[model samples]
Target: MSETPLDPRLDEDPYALQKHLGFRLTHWDVDYARLELPIEHFLMNRAGIPHGGIYATLLDTVMGYAGCYTGDPGHKKLALTLSLTTNFLSRPIGHVLIAEGRRVGGGASTFFAESTVSDETGEIIARGSGAFKYRKTRL
Candidate 1:
């Protein structure tokens, strides 16, 4: 994970909700983007673990970033998700969640991406994939 970031804004993520939830970009490259979501008490359920919705959100955000990147900060690719699927693997316990996403395949207008989310201990808690259309727009 990188300490200092080039930009916190992800082209695929233009919503204010992500920042409000304490999501931060930890790593980014030509192939992938990694994000970290804080595991605050409010994010937990009665079971004392973060809710599945939180994991799903992180996965989707990272995966969307993966497919929409053009390797240039000034020029960005925007993608709208067409389909998304997530699998909850286990219950995770930690102060934060680490998510990494990569582009799997696609073409000029559409793309596929896969994302994995893990706890602070590096235990995978969820996985997801998404198909998106690269909307010809820049943010």
Candidate 2:
């Protein structure tokens, strides 16, 4: 048996922030996407919990990917966020954080998506929704 190969684009993601944060694209579909991150002590805040910025990033990235997926997972689409709203619920202390995104609605040029972040133990850390516009050309 062999593991499925990773999307080469992931190695050179246009979003430098994702590469800097070591985000892994675990799954993706036409209207859905999931990203994962292993807990790192350095990501914690003064309260010893994951920073809100981290939560916000998970939400934004996941929801953006949900909008980006065009049918063929191999063809990566670029979606720019027009607006994003996040609601932080709890703090994550688990070894991993999982973010799942689902496309809600929109038309040809734009899209809407919602996403949730949870810990390995199934604790929801945050939820978010966003509006995104597809780029006219590929990056």
Candidate 3:
């Protein structure tokens, strides 16, 4: 499969958890983020389906990133999730899973975001929403 061109910032320094999950940051922009993951055996459960925790992790990560876009790479933005909710809609059927997130609304210090996980067929398998607090950055 041809690899998707990802945002360069993703390679700068990813957290260990992100690397371990093996999801790629395919896109990022103002109030938006998109990630993709190839289904792997290790990510499946005993029932041979992707684990629920994996879905939650992807949802949280994407949503948080949706609100973290800073036009300037040097000025990084971070957010701490205050609350997160994931709703599994259906089981996915495909070799790859795609997650997309969008920032909804909030003030400067806090924000809200929503996300969905979809299969290669474009069927949404999971949905999520979250509230986050912007972290203070050192001047």
Candidate 4:
């Protein structure tokens, strides 16, 4: 049997197109993916706090990527966030932020994931849970 080569998209920085959006894919396998994002001025709301949408986006991206890890070879899957609930636990005041996500349940076609956004000091600023559906594409 031959080994499948790594997907090139995985090497492309997800945040390269978004200004001030920095993300690092720390770990990923067939069933999981973990990423981190930094909190910058562009990600803040009017109150000088990290915007809720930013948290939502980060959660969605990380969780979606996790699902993609379980998809078939050469078949890319795009995940759509069907529902998401976020709880703001604390204010993140720092130069950097960290976001981690993991698949909690479900399968390759659909799944639920949990994510947390924290400051550099490891204080959680927001927690999120979301349901996503995966669509297989023939790209």
Find the 10 residues in a row with the least total lDDT in model 1: 6-15
Order the candidate numbers by TM-score, best to worst. Answer: 3, 1, 2, 4
Arranged by lDDT, best first? 3, 2, 1, 4
- 72-133 per-residue lDDT for model 2 (tens digits): 53665898999999999988767899998999999999999999999889899999999999
* TM-scores vs. true structure, each candidate: 0.86, 0.86, 0.91, 0.77
lDDT of each: 0.81, 0.82, 0.88, 0.71
RMSD from true fold, candidate 3: 3.1
Winner by TM-score between candidate 4 and candidate 3: 3
Steric clashes per prediction: 0, 0, 0, 0
**Residue 12, candidate 3: C-alpha displacement in angstroms:** 2.8
TM-score of 2: 0.86
**Cα lDDT over the full model 4:** 0.71
- The deviation in Å at residue 85 for candidate 1 is 0.9
TM-score, candidate 3, is 0.91
lDDT of 4 by residue, 1-139 (tens): 1234435555544555443577666665565666666666777799988788887777777777766673454555677888888888888767677677778888757899888878778788888888988776534
